[model samples]
Target: MFFALSKVLGFFALPSNLMISIGLVGALALFAGWVRLGGALLVISVLTLAVLGLSPLGNILLLVLEDRFPKPAENDNRPVAGIVVLGGSFDTIVAGARGEVALNESAERLTVIAELAKRYPEARIVFSGGQGTLFYSGATEAQVAARMFESFGIAPERITLEDRSRNTRENAVFSRDLVNPGAGERWLLVTSAYHMPRSVGCFRAAGFPVDAFPVDYRTRGYEDMTRPFRSVGEGLRRVDIAVREWVGLFVYRITGYTDALVPAPL
Candidate 1:
């Protein structure tokens, strides 16, 4: 139920969708002869679009989330029992059709996994993801990840694929159960930097303590303020992702899926 609601609400929450919705409301109001109200709404919509697209607000907003978890120190030599990589890295349908893996913007999730696999050859490799789309009847993300991992020279014996999970919570719960690490064994949770807080919280909530290995940063740091906006479409897309992640954190905390609104490193 949560998954379905999130999907429907997510569409409406997108900046583009919100703009269209407000415009539609204004159109209906004008048709009903509420001229002032309609005009005000229309103006507000345009201003909102400009603020989100032309300004650095989107990057600033994303920076807050992205900065919550920093990249782990490269020199730290901790014993890792395994590495768990989340989904959202591949287009399962495209991969299934083309007989090749097609990574999305979050391809760093997989690439990092490959590098980590080589760094810790003795540690287990787990990929968690399932069929997340509502109607796409194609290969699961885990299936595609398995093939990709194999291509990266990670032996099949070292990989554990949890392909039944549909969301972040499921990723933690399902992967924890699949791996079932021993006492004092530490696992590294790899996901996008913007997504690490929620991912870590969910893993801790599921009784799986993991060292965060955040990657795929979307923001260029505080310096993004000086950078020019390359495209309005890209800015809006970043806003959408930031908004969804913020909402996910809030919802997860309230529902006890996480122990904190924003989990921090210990």
Candidate 2:
């Protein structure tokens, strides 16, 4: 239910939603109360529309968020105990239940997982996900992740499954319960670079020492911030994703699901 609640709360967290709501309230007042209030609402909405259309506000938002979290590679010389793979849009599909796989825009995690399988054959592989659905499906997400590994020739004998997690916090908590991580057992956490902060935070919060190995780097721009942000749609999409993760982080902290302020070791 935390999962469902968080998803619902995210809708209210959008800047667009706030703009629309103000316009809506102004319209409602015009019908029952004041004409001036309605006019003010219309004015505000028009100004917002003009600003969003003319500027790279979305890119600026995404660019700033990406800058806030720096995911530099660690310069450590230590053998990892095991590799923990986090789930995302990477494996969500109609074929997920039937052992079929399709790639998200960034298929880096899947390829990186394959590399981990080859490099550390003896280290246990843990797959974490749940049946995060409002519709019927024959299998859990963990099953889908497992089958993808099967296609890559990973032995079923070496796989550990935690099929009841709906997000990163649960991914860490449930997988920890399944794997029983030992002290000094270093782990390489594989996920998109943009998502590394929350994933790493969740795992460490749940008592797992994971080295962040971020892939699928998304934020990029010219050294000159003055360059035109021509791709407003793409910029908006990135901003949306960044906003969602940040809201998720704050929500997790408030309910004690995570400590968002804790400086995550990136």
Candidate 3:
């Protein structure tokens, strides 16, 4: 719901949208003879909106934001319990109407979970996430992940699941409640590299300290960055996500969600 609302906010709240609304409102206000500055405001708003609406300039701003976000790391320590993978994309976590499951980006995330689960058969492999927009019927994400794991031959008893969470915050809280870890006991938090900081912060806020095992990095290695004339669209997307996370770290820290906001283990 928040994601949808953000899309709407980003769209209708654009300067163009605001200018259109203002123009209409200003015209309405003129009948009351109090439209002195209103007309000027409308003109400025329109001009500003026009430029922002057409150009891909926000993409440049996104690049700056991306640079400001923390770096994500690939760590070596294995948790006592296995990793808890956060479902971010439909490929990572989604269900068909008839309840079929699919695994996308089966790399540093789902595949890694499977590998670890196979290697550490005794460890508890918890699946996180509840039903998202596709299934409003109230199924949790963990439920879906468990089923997927089951198809791969892991027993129901081996997998612990917390599917009641509606968002990443809930994902951490609910998982923490299930794991019920003591001080100094570690659990690994697995999610997209772009999403690790927020995931770690949320879990830390809930009082569970999980080592971040960042995967599915969208940003390529330095060799990839060496290419000049990188597409602005992709760069802007990375920037937008990184910027949001940079802000997310600050917000989580200020709200007391995390005790520390350490960057990627460089």
- The candidate that achieves the highest lDDT relative to the unseen native structure: 1
> lDDT, candidate 3, residue 200?
73
Give a tens-digit lDDT track for model 2, residues 47-122. Answer: 7644553455555544543444454344544576788887764446565544567556667776777877777777
Cα RMSD (Å) between model 1 and the true structure?
A: 1.6
Separate clash counts for every candidate? 0, 0, 4
Error of 1 at 232 (Å): 1.4
Q: Candidate 2, clashing residue pairs?
A: none
lDDT of 3 by residue, 1-266 (tens): 75566445444444445567777777766776767767766677666555544444444433332333343233543445656778754443335544655555533566567766776677778777766553245334465567668767877787887767666677888888888877776567777766676677678678777776666765444443333324544444444454555555665577666656633332
Query: With candidate 1 superimposed using the best TM-score fit, by how many Å does residue 160's alpha carbon deviate from the native?
Result: 0.3
Arrange candidates by TM-score, highest first: which order? 1, 2, 3
lDDT of 3 at 54: 43
Per-residue CA lDDT of model 1 for 116-231, tens digit only, reads 98788899999999999876777899989988898899888999999999999999999988888787998888999999999999999999999988899988789986564677
Candidate 2: residue 105 lDDT (0-100): 65
